[model samples]
Target: MAEIVLANVSKSYGAVPVIEDVSLAIGSGEFVVFLGPSGSGKSTLLRMIAGLETIDSGTLTIGGQRCEQLPPGQRGVAMVFQNYAIYPHMTVRENMAFGLRNINLPQAEIASRVADAARILEIGALLDRRPAELSGGQRQRVAIGRAIVKEPRAFLFDEPLSNLDAALRVRTRVELAELHQRLRSTMIYVTHDQTEAMTLADRIVILNERRIEQIGTPLEVYMRPVSRFVASFVGSPAMNFLEVDVSRRGAERLVTLPSGAALPVPIDLPNDGRYELGVRPENLRVVPSGGDLVGEAVIIERLGDRTLIHVRLADGRSLTAQDSGRSNVAPGDRVALGIDRAEMHLFDASGRAWHPAQAQAVRATETA
Candidate 1:
């Protein structure tokens, strides 16, 4: 296993830049995921690491060796593509052994490596079957086994489970997590799916238009997003953002909603002229009358275990809140809402988080 480092690395096609001055360190034996929407440079960045795309500037080092100039085969990295890329006519064993054979390894050694990989992937029984005969998930496993047999210093996965059905995707996700635990190799995965990034990564790198937005553990990014973009992108149902004017009520700062209602400030926010109040659905509670915020329930989504309420406030801004699945509230019901002061987040005009004291003061005012 090896640590991968990128220092001011960038990629561009002519004048159109795909990745811009991206620098990051992936530690040895770490599972790091690159997460973003399509055209967000996530896959482009992954390909740059695999040497499938040329870097316009900067350096890439793997295991302490500069690899920007090295060919992919010599980088000591193996990549599993989204398409599986298995040979239709080749058996699983043959597909796994093909790379080793091309390098003129001894027959016995190639066979041993292939066998070991198949056993680890739990596909030994299917070794003699051709790609066409195997299921989609099985074929994908063969593709991974092919990479495993190479024994590279690191593994790169480009949306490896995107092609599978929902049930199969979940199963393969678990299998990949198990594989990482057993191999303990440095892995870099790229995906547009937040669920995949949250579940598999030791750290998630949030990428936006050619730049890194935030890098942190799953819970860190979810609970304490540094930017409004991350706050809205990282969670299911996303966080609710309401534009508010920051005004002082006595000595404390209060956020005035568009509807002319004021909520207590929990955090000490800069008396900045403008700000946004961010509250996650899970942090907002349906309360009896006299709560800090009031909204009319516009839509209700009832999942088996939980319900999501899309509420339209008096000012026309909408917010979603999570509730117990047994909640009996129907559309058109006016409900009072309480936001957990500790869970409230405040963003400045530039969308960055304000100081904790500012946040706490806002919460305190709202609760008061």
Candidate 2:
């Protein structure tokens, strides 16, 4: 396995820069995911590591060797694409063995490698089938198997599951997690899907514009986002942001909603000026009358075990709360919403967040 490192790396098209001064160290045998929206340079960054995109400045090192100028074939990395780039005319076994032949390995060695990869991927039964005869998930497994046959130091997956159906995606995702655990190979996966980033990554690198926003674990990014953009972009149904006034009384911080209701929060207050309160849907609860904030439910989304209530406050701000699945709240109904102070996030005018004491300490350490 190899530890991949990028030091102040940058890329640009003429005067338009795509990636700017990004430095990251992906540990050996670690699974790190590059997560961002379209045009966020995640795929570009992955390609840079693969030698498909040239690094304009700084360094790219793999296994302690500088590889910014190395050819893709010599980088000791295998990449799986979103399209599952396998040969349609070749059988699964042929497709996997094709890459090995070019390396001048003995035929028996190539067969052994292909057989081992097929066993690992549990696709030995499909080895005789052509790409045309395989399901999308099976074809993707074949693509992955081809990479495995190379026995590269690391694996690069670019939205590998994006092409699968929902159920197949779920299954393939589980298989991938198992593969990582089994091989313990260094892997860098790029995707815009938050679910993939959240579930698959040992650490996630969130990119925005031409820079990285944050790097942390799934729960860390979800609960302690360093910026407003990180908090809003990493969660499903997104986080609800409300303009709030904060005041300090002794050691406690009191957050006052626009409706004039005050709730004591565990976070420390920043200096004067309004802060945005970020609460995930799961952390917001609906009360009857006399809740902290009063609003009218404008939309209700029921998803089996949970119900999402989108409420419009008196001041015209909207908030979504996750309620009980059996709760009978409907649109047009008056609902009182309470914020989970313990789970809330406070974002300053600059979009930087102040999390709970535990998270703040960790954030401070990272900065230090």
Candidate 3:
């Protein structure tokens, strides 16, 4: 019963608030990721859960026991840090056994725990090596092994893969996922990398400016973002924003772009002032002739299998569209982008997002 809950938990550094009125429940044996850019307080939130930082205004409970005022060791959570916090002066075995030794556990139990963790992390062969002698990935595994010996209720990881090389990072990320499946332990990982969050977490908690913007499964957040900030931040190339006017003409709901091109998007709106049309690069297609949107190719990014075309619209704003690797479209070439209504997202002045399906459902309900 390692379920964790935070009820109106918040933290502040003087007058500056880091985490404010955040409440969430993490099911036992679930893998959750805190994702956001630097200074967004993802790590701070994780630290709060770890008891390294004091909670300012709310209560935290781990496995149904209040832990906000508890010491980190008493909170029933183990943390693996970005810096492999394992002692460099000690061998891998010694580093993994250090915490157990501090508690004056039976020498046999300490040795058994250390041996089991090493075997689980596949570092049993390197148990006698110091941190300097081991590779970055191996050292990180040692750090994790140190945490595993505690048999805590949950695990906390703060950008543990950041120090590894790109290839190694990918490899280690997969290893972590496998390890989670093996242990089925409640793990809360903190990372700014969306790729890591998308691939690793069962659910992602997206934070921005010291506040949580959204929390959902990867596909849910990717397919249906709640706000413009979320839509823009979650994807690789990010969502494109085009200023447009929404108005009702007869029975047709139209979105008039800056270039006077109208997209017939039948969605519920006030049809007042300017709104932002959100579309992803993959949703926009480069057509041969006239399309829903017209633009000129200003940049062509050629990856191995795909080419990304940066289309500069008539209004001077640019958008990224995907094309095949063999695409002959060059810079300065005239191109038009086609988009489907179902794939489009509309954002009001307040930055709230609405999809075609959601809007139609709302309209149907209103008319009913």
- Candidate 3 to native Cα RMSD, angstroms: 1.5
**lDDT tens readout by residue for model 3, 1-368:** 29999889888999998888999899999999999888888999999999999999899999989999999989989999999888889999999999999999999999999988988899999999999999999999999999999999999999999999999999999999999999999999999899999999999999988888999999989999999999999998888899888887888788998878888885677655688999998898887788888888999999969889999887779899988889999999998888867789999889898887787789888899
User: What C-alpha lDDT do the candidate models reach, one value each?
Assistant: 0.90, 0.92, 0.91
lDDT tens digits, residues 8-59, model 2? 9999999999999999999999999999989999999999999999999999
lDDT (10s digit) by residue, model 1, range 1-368:
99999999999999899999999999999999999888999999999999999988999999999999998999999999999999998988899999999999999999999989988999999999999899999999999999999999999999999999999999999999999999999999999899999999999999988999999999988888889989989999899888878888788777786667676675675464678888889888788677767889999999979889999988788889878889988999998887777787888878797645555567878899
Best by lDDT: 2
lDDT, candidate 2, residue 251? Answer: 70
lDDT: worst 10-residue window of model 2: 264-273
Q: Which regions in candidate 2 have their CA more than 4 angstroms from the true location? A: 358-368
Measured against the true structure, the TM-scores of the candidates, in listed sequence, are 0.94, 0.96, 0.96
* Model 1 / residue 222 / CA error / Å: 0.6
Q: All predictions: root-mean-square deviation over Cα?
A: 3.6, 2.2, 1.5
Q: Local error of candidate 3 at 238, Å?
A: 1.3
How far in Å is the alpha carbon of 72 misplaced in model 1? Answer: 0.4
lDDT of 1: 0.90
